[model samples]
Target: MVSRPHLPEDRMLVEQLRLQLGNIGSSVIPTILLALLLVWVISNDSNAFAMRAWCGITILFKLYLAWDARRLLASEISPERARRLLRRKMVINAIDGATWGSLAWAALGTTTVAGSVLVVAVLAGVAGSSMSSLAPILPVFIVFGAAELVVLGAKLWLMGDPAYDALAVAAVLYTAALLGQARNASRAARRAIGLRFENLELIERLRVETEHAQAAHRAADEANLAKSRFLAAASHDLRQPIHAQGLFLEVLARSQLSADQHDALANARATWQASAEMLDTLLDFSRIEAGVVEPQMQVFPLQPLLNKIENELAPQADAKGIVYRSRETHAAVRSDPALVALILRNLVSNAIRYTEQGGVLVACRARGEQVLLEVWDTGIGIEPAQHQAIFREFHQLGNAERDRRKGLGLGLAIAQGLARALGQPLSLVSTPGRGSVFRVALPAARAGVVAEGAADAMPGPSRAFDLRVLVIDDDESVRTGMRQLLGAWGCVCDLADSIEEAQALARAHRPALVISDYRLRELRTGAEAIAALRAEYGADLPALLITGDTAPQRLREARATGVPLLHKPVLPSQLHRAMSAVLMGRELDSSFAGLEARRA
Candidate 1:
C-alpha cells in the first residue's frame, strides 16, 4: 500500500483509543470463558483449587479492564487523556496475558499430555483471533502478545525434555508471525481513518465554494435590476426637455427668421434628432423585452422598403465619403415591413459608421422559400469570436471610448430582437480586417398570399383643422410647447397640467381631439387621464398617449391601454400624422404605424 503522511498527533491518539476500547468488550467475555475451560482441561485433583483460584483472579482482572473501557468511552477523550487511558489498558492487558501464560507453567507437568496439548492449542487460538480486535494501537497489541509468548517460552525452556525445548522455539517463531500480521492490520486501519478525514475536508471546501457562487449570482442580478431602473428614470427625465424643445422648434420654424438663424435652428434640430433616435432605440429594446412587439405579417414588395432605407441612411454614408448602394430587386417577401426596415437601417448605418474608406451595399437574394436580405460592408470588420457578442445590448466593437455619435451600442441588439420576434433568422459572417455580411432570412412571399401595395405618396399641405384640441402634460414647458405647436396648425389648444384640470377643460371646451402625456402628477398615469376624459366625453373621443418611459413594465402598461401611444420627443411631422389619423377616424397613418412597430 502507498503511504501517506502521518495524521496529527492529537487526532491519531484519540482515534486509536476509540478503536482499542470499542473492541475490549468482545475480548473480555471470551477471555474469561477460556480461562474456566483451561481449568477444567488441565487441573488435577490437588491443583484444581489452585487452578480455580488463578481462574478467579483472571476473571477479576478481565472485568476490571472491561469496566475501564466503558468508563473511557463515556468520558470526553482529549489527546492527553487518551494517551493515559491507552497506556493503562496496555498494562492491564499485559498482566492478563502473563496470567494466562502462568497457566501453561502450572498445567504442563501436572496434567496428561493430551490436556497439555489442549492448553497450547487454546493459547494459539486466542493469539490468532486477537489480530483483528487489538491491532489498532500496535504497541498495546505488541505488549500483550509478547508478555504471554515470552512467559510461555521461558517456562517451556526450563523443562529437561528435548520435545519441550522444541515447543519453546516454536512459540518464539509464532510470536514473530502474529506481530507481523498485527502491524499490517494496524496500518490498514490508520490509512482508512486518514482517507475519511480527507473526504470530509473536500466536502466542506465544496460547500464554501457553492455558497460564494450563489452570492455572486445574486449580486449580478441585483446590479442588472439597478441598471434597468436607472435607465428608465434617466430616459424619462431626459426626454421631457427634448420633447418640449422639438415642439418649440417646430413652432419656431413657422416664424420669420434670417438665413443664418435658420441654419442654427437646423443644427439644433439635427442635434435633437440624434438624441431622439438614441432614446427610440432604447424604447424599441424595452418594447421587445415587454413582448409588446407583434409583427404585422403581410406580403410586400421588398424594393420599396430597401429604397426607403437607402433614402434615409444614404446621407450618413455620403457624409463619410463612402458610396452606399442597393441592388434593386422586384422580388416580394412576407414579413413586418416596419420591423424589417428597422433591421436593415441598423445594419446599413452600422456599416457606414465603421467603414473608414470603403462603401456599404444592401441587397437581397433568393434562397429557396426564403429571401436573404444581405448587408455587405467594407467596414473595420468584426472578428469571428465577436460575432455573437456584437448582437448583445451595449456591446460594441472598436468603440471603447463610447462615442455617442457612433450610436448607442443597441442597434444590432434591437435588430436581432425584432428578427426573433418576427420568427425570422439573422446571421453574420465577417473577417477581422476585410469586410462583413449580415444576412436576415425572410420568408418569401408564398403562393395565394395577396401582396399589399408598396408605393410612396406625399401628403398634401396641412390645412386649418379649426378643431379644439385638449393637451395634458405635467411639465409647464411641454404644455406651452404643445399649445404653440397646435396653434401653428390652426387648431385651438386647451392645455392642462393635471388630470382634474384636463377633465375640467374637456367639459368646458368639448375638445375634438385629446392629447395627453402618459405619466402625470400624483403618480397617476396619462392612461388614467385619458380614461377620465373619455368617460367625461364619450368612448368615441379620439385620444393619443405620449410617454417618455422606456421601462419594460411601463411599455407593457402603456400598450395595454388600447389608446394609440406615441413616445415623447415625437417630431412635429410624426405628431401631426398621429393626430391626423385620429381625427380622420383611420388606423394611424402607415408612417405612424411603422414608427410604432419600430418602437415595439
Candidate 2:
C-alpha cells in the first residue's frame, strides 16, 4: 500500500469559513441599517412607554441580525446553499418590517412608517424569488406613498390638534421618501449578487468539462502511439519471410523445370502475392492512422491512372467472370497522381472481390466545382447502417461468410482515410443485397498543365530504367530482395545497410538512382540517408524513399524533400512503375505518351 500526503483539517475549515463570511456580511449589513431607521421614526411620539417599547424592538432586531451574521461566518456554503440562505434572509426581513409596521400603527394611530417599510420588504422579497424578478419594486414604491398620505390625513382628523399635526405629516413624508431610496438600493445589490453567483457557477461547469475533454484526448493520443510502435515492429518481422520468399521465387523463375513443376511454382507465387498484398494493406492502414500518408500535388492526366487500375484489376475481374470498365468525360485533373491511383486501386479491387457474377464500372462526372470519381459495383452491397462503419478500422460486413481469403477488411478503411488526408470526401450510397456506389469528390484543378519536355513527343514503350540503382536499408532481407528486383530490370545494383555504408557506395559508384528505407538503426532514418547521399551526390540525383513508418511528421518531412515515396511490402509492379515514372519522366506506354506530353 502507498501512503498519500494529507491536508490539515483546521486550515481547510478556516478557508471554508472565510468564503461564507464574505457572502453573509454583504447581505446583512444593509438590512440592519434599514431596520434601525424604522425604529427611530416610530419612537418620535410623546408617550414614554411607546418610546421604550420601540427602542427594545430595535435592540432585539439588531441582536437577531448579529446572530445570523455569526452563523454565516461559522460554516462554508456552496452556491446552491447560498441561494437558500438569501431566500431565508428575505423572509426574515419581510417579517421584521411587518412587525415594526404593525406596532407603529397601533401606538400612533397611523400607517405612515408601517406602509413605507412594508413596500421595501416586499421589493426585497421579489429580488429573492429568483435572480431575474426585481422589476416590480418601482410600482410598489408609488403605491406606498399614496397609502401613507391617506393614513396621515385620517390621523390628523381624529386627533384634532393643529399644533403637532403639521410636524407629524412632515415626518411621515420624509421617512417615506428615505425608505423609497433604500428599496431601490437593495434591488441593485440583489442584482449584483445574482450576477456574481451565475458567473461562479459557469466557471465551475467549464472547468469540469475542460478536464473531461483533456482526459479523452490524452487517451486517444496514447492509443495512437502504441499502434504506431506495434506496426513498426510487425512490419520489421514480416519483411524477413517476404524477403526469403522473393529470393526463392527468383531462383525458381530462372531454373528450367518440367511444365508441371513450373505450374506448381506459379501457384505458389500467387499465394505469396496474395499474402504480400494483405500485408501491404495492413501497413497502409497503420500509416493512414498515423497520418503519414501525404498527397503529392501534380497535374497528371486522370485517364492514365484510371487506365492503370483498369489494366491491373481487369485480370482479376475476368478470372472471376465479372466485367470491368472505366469512363471519364473530363480527362485531366490536378492532384496527387499516385494517391489518386491508390484510392482507385482499392475501390476497384474491393468491387471485384465482392461481385460474384455481375460487373464493376469506374466513371467520373463534373458536380458544381468538383469532380465526382465514382466506382459502382453489382456486388453484395452494404447496409445503410454499415456504410460509415465499413470505413472504420477492422470493420467488415458479412465477411465471415463471403471472401475472407481476399482480404482482412482494411481496403475501404485505408481508402477513406487517404481521401480525408488529401482533403477530399469519399461517400457511399448502398442498399443491402442491391448494388453500391462509392464516390471520391475532389476540387477541380487548373486546366492545360504540362510536365517537362512537351514539344518533341515520341510514341514508344514506357522507357525502362537503364541506369545504376542503389538500395539502402537496415533489414538485410529487404535490401537483398530490392537489389535482385532492380538487377532483374537491367540496372546495375549497389546495396548498403546504413547511411554510412550508403555514403561510401555513393562516393565509389556515383549511382544514377538512390533508394533507402525510412527507419534505420539508432533512430536514424531513410530521410537522413537521402540527405547524406544528396550532399555527396548533387541534390537533383533522382532519389526515392521507401518506409514502413506511418507517423504524419515523417511523411511531411519526406514530402518536403521532394522525393517519390512508397510504403512497404512493396509490390513488384508498383516498384517497377514508380521507378520508371521518377527516372524517365515518361508515361508507361506509347498510347499514354500524349497524356504525359499534355501534362508537360
Candidate 3:
C-alpha cells in the first residue's frame, strides 16, 4: 500500500504546533518564578487551612496562564484570526493577574512544607497544561519538576550546614536562567513575525509592478494596432490624388510650349514637387518611427550622388541667381544609397531656398576612416543657439510670413531622421548672417570600383518604345493623364476606371503591362483589378500597384500579393525606371519562351 501524501491542512497544524512551542518557551520562566516565590513564602509560614487555599489559588492562576499562552500561540500561527485570539488572550491575562494576586495573599496567610510543594506542583501543572493543549506532555512536565525538587533537597542534605547558602545561590541562578531563556525566546518570536511582515510587503510590491508592466504592454499593443489601421486607411486615401498628380505632371512636362510659358509651367511643377516632397517626408518619418525602414547597406560611389544633387539643385539656385557648385572627390562609401540621397536632397533644397547671394557648394573629403559629405551655403546662417532647434519638426527661425512660402519646415527634420536611420552623424556649424555648413560623415569603402551613372539627374530624351500598357484607376482625371503620358511614351494606352472596365479592355486587346491604383470606387481595389485582368488574359501579366498609404496592414497586404509597389506621388523618373524594369522582365520571359518553343 502507498503512503498518503501530506495535505495543506496537515502542514498548517504542524505550523500551529511550532508556534505553540515558541509561545510556551517565551512564558515558561516567568510562570516558574512566580510559582517558586509563592511556594517559598508558603513553606516559611504557619497556617494549615490557608496553605490549602493558597495551593488552590495558585492552580487557578496557572490554568489562566495556560489559556493565555494557547491564545498567543494561536495568534502567532494564524494572523487572520489574531484579532479574535488576542482579545481572548487579553481576557485570560486579566484573570491570570487576579488569580496571582489572590495566591500572593494566601502565601502570606499559610506556612508548611506541604503548602510549598503544592504551590510548586501547581506552577509546573499550569506550564504543562499549556503544552498539553498543543501536544501530550503534561504528566512528563509534572514528573520532571518533582525530580528537580528531589535533586535540590538531596544536594542540600549532603553539604549539611554550608549547603544552605549554596542552595540559596543555586535557586537564584536557576530562576534568572529561566527568565533569560524566556526573554530570548520572546525576542526570536518577534523577529520571526517581523520577517513574515516584510515578506508580505515585498510580495505586494512585486504584484503591483507586474500589474503595471501588463498595463503598459496592453497600451502599446493597442497603439500599434491603431497605427496599422490608420496607415492602411491614410495610404489608400492619399495615393489616389498623388497618382493623378504624377500622371498629370508627366503629361504637362511632355506638352510643347514657349520658353516663357515653360518657365510658368516649371514653377507649377516646383509647387507639385514640393507637395510631393512633403508627403514623402511624412511617409518616411512614419516608416522610420515604426521601425520599418531597414537600412540596405551597399558599397556605392559617392561622386554620382553628389553629381545628381548638383544637377537637381542647379536650376533652383540659378532661378534665385545664386551659384551652385560641387567639388568632386574620388570616394566610395558603404551606406544605404537611397537614404543618403534623400539626406543630400533635403540639404541641397534648404541651401537653395535660404541663399540670397553667393550660392551653395557641396563637397566630399576624406577624413580618417570616414568620408565627409558637406553642404555649405552663403545664406541666412543659423545662430549658434538655434542650430539644434532647426532640426526639430516644423521649426522655422524667421517670421512666419517670410518663411511661409518656402514650404513646411520638415526638410531639416527629415534629413536628421534619415541620417540617424542610416547610423550616420549629421552635424551643423554656422555663423549668423554669414553661412552654414551641414556635414554627414559616412564609413569609407574600398577604392577600386567605377561609379554608376548618376540616376537622380534630370532625365534626357525619352527612348523609343513599342510596349502596350493598360492603366486602371477609379478617378477619371488619373486615367486621362495616364493615357496622355503613356501615349507620349510611344506605348498604346488602354484606360479603365473599374475591374469590369479592365476586364472588357483585356478581352478586346491583350495589353503587355498593367498599372493600377490601390484604391478604387465601388469597393473595388487594385488587387481585385489585377485578378480580373489576369482571369481574362493570363496569370503572367506584368503589373505594378501604386499607393500612398503608410499603414503596416496595407503594406502587408501589398507585400503578400507579390506585386511591384511604388508610393505616390510618383516622380516621372521613378515611373520611367519602374516601366523599364517591367518591360525588361517581359522581354526576357518572351525570349526564354521562344527558345523553349524551338527546343520542343
| The best candidate in terms of TM-score | 1
How do these models rank on lDDT, best leading?
A: 1, 3, 2
What tens-digit string does per-residue lDDT give for candidate 3 at 1-600?
954333343333334444544555555556556555555556443554554565566565565566656655555455455445444444554454345334424542244546544543553344344333322222222233334434444444444555444643554455345444444554454455545656766799999999999999999889867865775466556666766776787687778889998998888877777666656666665555545555667778887777766766798899999999998787889887767887888899888888899999999999999999999999999988898899976687675774656856877887898789888999999998999999999999865654454223334455756877888877787778778887887889898888888888888888999999876788667988898788777788888887666665455565556667677777766667667767677321210111111111
Q: List the pairs of residues colliding in candidate 1.
A: 518-526
Off by over 4 Å in 2: 1-57, 60-64, 76-221, 255-261, 286-308, 318-337, 364-372, 400-403, 421-424, 441-471, 482-495, 500-514, 533-544, 561-564, 571-600
Better of 1 and 3 by lDDT: 1
Q: Can you list the residue pairs that collide in candidate 3?
A: 45-111, 46-111, 231-551, 235-549
What is the C-alpha local distance difference test score of each model? 0.83, 0.64, 0.65
Write candidate 1's Cα lDDT for 9-121 as tens digits: 77887987888888889888788878888887678886787788888988898798788889888988998777777778788778877877877777777788898788788
lDDT score of model 2? Answer: 0.64
Clashing pairs in 2: 450-599, 450-600, 451-599, 451-600, 518-526
lDDT of 3: 0.65
